[model samples]
Target: MKNQNFVRNLVGTAILAALVLALQLLLGSLKLGPFNITLTLVPIILGAVLYGPLSAAFLGGLFGFLVCISVISGNDAGGFMLFSQKPVITLALCMIKSTAAGYLSGLVARSLSKKNATLSLFLAAGIAPVVNTGIFILGLLLFFQDTLVLWANGQDKVIDFLLFSILGINFTTEFLVNLVLVPVLARILRNLRFVKQELAV
Candidate 1:
């Protein structure tokens, strides 16, 4: 039984990881408005809820790697710009933000599941984008402030430009998407639970 569970987990993790890779590589440039919307976060959140922190982290790391590929390939103009300025810092930021987002979301979900399962799932979904974007903004301020200032185009308030002008739309879209997905994710969880129970029997 333990071995079967392990195999199931391994397969599930692989499937999620593949989804992450495909979304990052193929649909990474998917955009609704001005900024690019990252669809990869959804699967990472799903992995967090379905598997655990480690699996989520691995998927997130894979997402980060694909982003790095985009940067290196010059497909991500902003990322490439940052990479040109600071290669190591840019790559590290890419990896850290996504991985931390996944790990933290999974950890939060696991910890809070003991209380209210639904609330924990919603919060976990919500926190993924928050942590991902928060770390990105911090990394910009810390390492790429100059680039941000340049992008601000002589604006007096860099922070305002960064948050409101740059990240506002993108963040809102990601957050809303995650929240709206709660129902679908909840249904998936229930179905999975049913399958597991049946298998156990």
Candidate 2:
């Protein structure tokens, strides 16, 4: 029974990973002024809520890999480069952001599940964009702060830009997209028999 359960969980994780990849590809095809909205993290959140942090991390890493490939190959119109001129750093940021988002989602879900499963799932889905945007902004500040400051022509302006860009524009856009999409997707997935049997443990 233990082995069977493990196999089932493994299969479920694989499906979730594939779904993440598919969503990334689908979102890549759309354009939104240098920012394409994606529900890729939804699967990661669901996997984390269902399986555990390790599985979620693995799926997140897989999603990051897809993003890296798309960026490097110019498959998504090279928006992944983000004026960095450095593919390695860009790739590293993607991996760290996705992994952290997934791990946090799983941890939050696990902690809150006993009290309120529905609320926990909701938080799990909602936290990814916040985490993702926050980290990306931090990374930008750390790596490109000098360039941004120069561009802004003042330190104060640079700070303001970072604050607004990170917390206002980027976070708001990602939050709105996730807010609209994740609940519906979570509901649909929750109703699936396989999801219930495997994830509701």
lDDT of each: 0.79, 0.72
Tell me how far the alpha carbon of residue 8 in candidate 1 is from the true structure, in angstroms, after superposition. 1.8
**All candidates: TM-score:** 0.89, 0.81
Error of 2 at 28 (Å): 4.7
| Residue-level error in angstroms, candidate 2, position 150 | 6.9
- After TM-score superposition, the amount by which residue 4's alpha carbon in candidate 1 deviates from its true location, in angstroms, is 2.5
lDDT of 1 by residue, 97-197 (tens): 99999999889877877676677778889999999989988998889878888877765878677777557777878888887875485576557762132
- Per-residue error (Å), model 1, residue 198: 14
